[model samples]
Target: MVSSDDTYLSMRGGVSRGIRRMGGEEIYKESQDCRILNALSIGDVVVTSAGNLPANKIFHGTVIDWQLELFPSKKIIQKVVHDCLIKANHYGYKTIVFPLLGTGAGCLNKQIAWEIMLKQIIMDLSTIHQTLIEVVITLYGRETLSDLNWKFFINEMQAKWEIK
Candidate 1:
């Protein structure tokens, strides 16, 4: 799973800690150094290797800066999601997984975050012609984001996409 962050050096909190566990300390360090040259602001993304994980790459998106805002704006989240998908397509990655961004330490409303994410994903997918890219939306760890109501989200997405 990819961790979301601001343009800061410290990699604390849930997702960042997960990255550290997955041997992504090097990637995090590199990202920090890269950020000095190219700082990651809201709606910006930074792609990195998944380290020892099964995924081919990790797309670190800067959705919110806790220091600046209490929660991320829906527009910013949508843009970040779009950017991540574009980056994934550019890298020829057919499959990608995303956590419920802006919900953990960013303290965004779970329902609102899910709605924005699903809407942006559906919109982005509709623009693609015949590409078979698989986008996976995961909770990362259920314990960490217990407030996220997945059942409601799945039902909403199914209704939106008319999925059987």
Candidate 2:
């Protein structure tokens, strides 16, 4: 199933938005031949050797770069998310997983990031092969989940898709 990682949240008093750390293990690339590869980027393509992974193709999507804004403008985030979906569709991927964009050192507010993400997903749903493609958001920390705004954003997003 598509899911996010559990994160440890540090809270002080009643306020949110504090330090966060790893709370779960990552899924190793599976050992099965991939049916397709989709690179979602407007820049150079990159490839790395994974000695034992089963997937034959690896897609390098330059969704974010350090030269770019750490907390990119909302429009850019939306564009990149849309681009990822389009590229996946272009390559006929039926299932895809994405980490929360711009939440790392990028330091964008989680609520804003999620809002843009959901908007892009909703826009793409009616256009792509909706039944075949699945989008998964991987959360890397539990502490990050304390944002009530983000929780509300997720609820609204799920409401739009009836996809709880």
Candidate 3:
């Protein structure tokens, strides 16, 4: 929703933009209904129909409280990661793709966010299969991988976690 008024939404998020690029526009609308949006709160994780996305269910986790602070904290990041992992494991999901939460929408500092999110994920998942799960850390951007230290991130992921 865009606003001609001063307070109207000015832009769509990266995730929504990517989804739209993938031909999930209708599903995007379905996922953005008042109920789903309203039910989600900071630190809360909720599951909704995947709609047109490839997955069957999408777990929406709230790590940033736009009302509370300028950036998200380690605890908030950890909480959402832990909760989402538990929920995904409960559903017996073998694969979960986690976008580096709080790193977007003018939120957390990227380096610190990466550390906290990765540590929590590795520590928690270790108790599960190592876990036998494929974790995808999505960093969506308009630039190419050469623009960022993609190799460093990949090395960190491999060195820190025994990803399946």
Candidate 4:
């Protein structure tokens, strides 16, 4: 899954840019897909076929809209992440990968973004006892974000789920 701006334009930067750079032609063309008729609002999620990528699907969440006047909200981030998980379950998917929602083009602080994303993941997973859903959060940065020990933080959260 990737965080996309509300407009879903051919964003030449951020997550979209990386995918494009890696030859995600089908994913790129979803911008013109009729199902995406209008600009998405914050927290909205749209699923599309992964172009040439190996994944079965791509979940594009509207976690930010840098062009808009509205500031990114923690609530919006939580909503998008949770919604994407639900959507994945709807498709009978056992696993879904997500990127830090607001850290890239959203211009959000990396630490805050990670905290918000991890918290939302934990909360959602807590309520999902019906089935085992594996979730992965990946960070792709040009420069090291040494401030947060992400591996340690994620493992700490994993331990809380140890007995559940």
Which candidate has the top score in TM-score? Answer: 1
Return the candidate ranking by TM-score, descending. Answer: 1, 4, 3, 2
- Clash pairs detected, candidate 2: 4-138, 4-139, 5-139, 6-142, 7-141, 7-142, 7-143, 8-142, 8-143, 9-143
lDDT of each: 0.73, 0.46, 0.58, 0.71
Residue 38, candidate 1: alpha-carbon lDDT: 82
What is the lDDT ranking, best to worst? 1, 4, 3, 2
**Candidate 1 minimal-lDDT segment of 10 residues:** 139-148
Question: lDDT tens digits, residues 58-86, model 2?
Answer: 33223334433233457656665665566
**Residue pairs with backbone overlap in model 4:** none
| Residue-level lDDT tens digits of model 4 in 111-140 | 777788888878877777524368877777
Candidate 2 off by > 4 Å: 1-70, 128-132, 143-151, 154-164
- TM per candidate comes to 0.81, 0.54, 0.67, 0.79
Model 3 CA deviation exceeding 4 Å by range: 1-11, 20-39, 128-132, 142-164
Highest lDDT: give the candidate number: 1
Pairs with steric clashes in candidate 1: none
RMSD of each: 3.0, 10.2, 6.3, 3.3
Q: Write out the backbone clash pairs for model 3.
A: none
Error of 3 at 66 (Å): 2.8
Pick by lDDT: 3 or 4, better one? 4
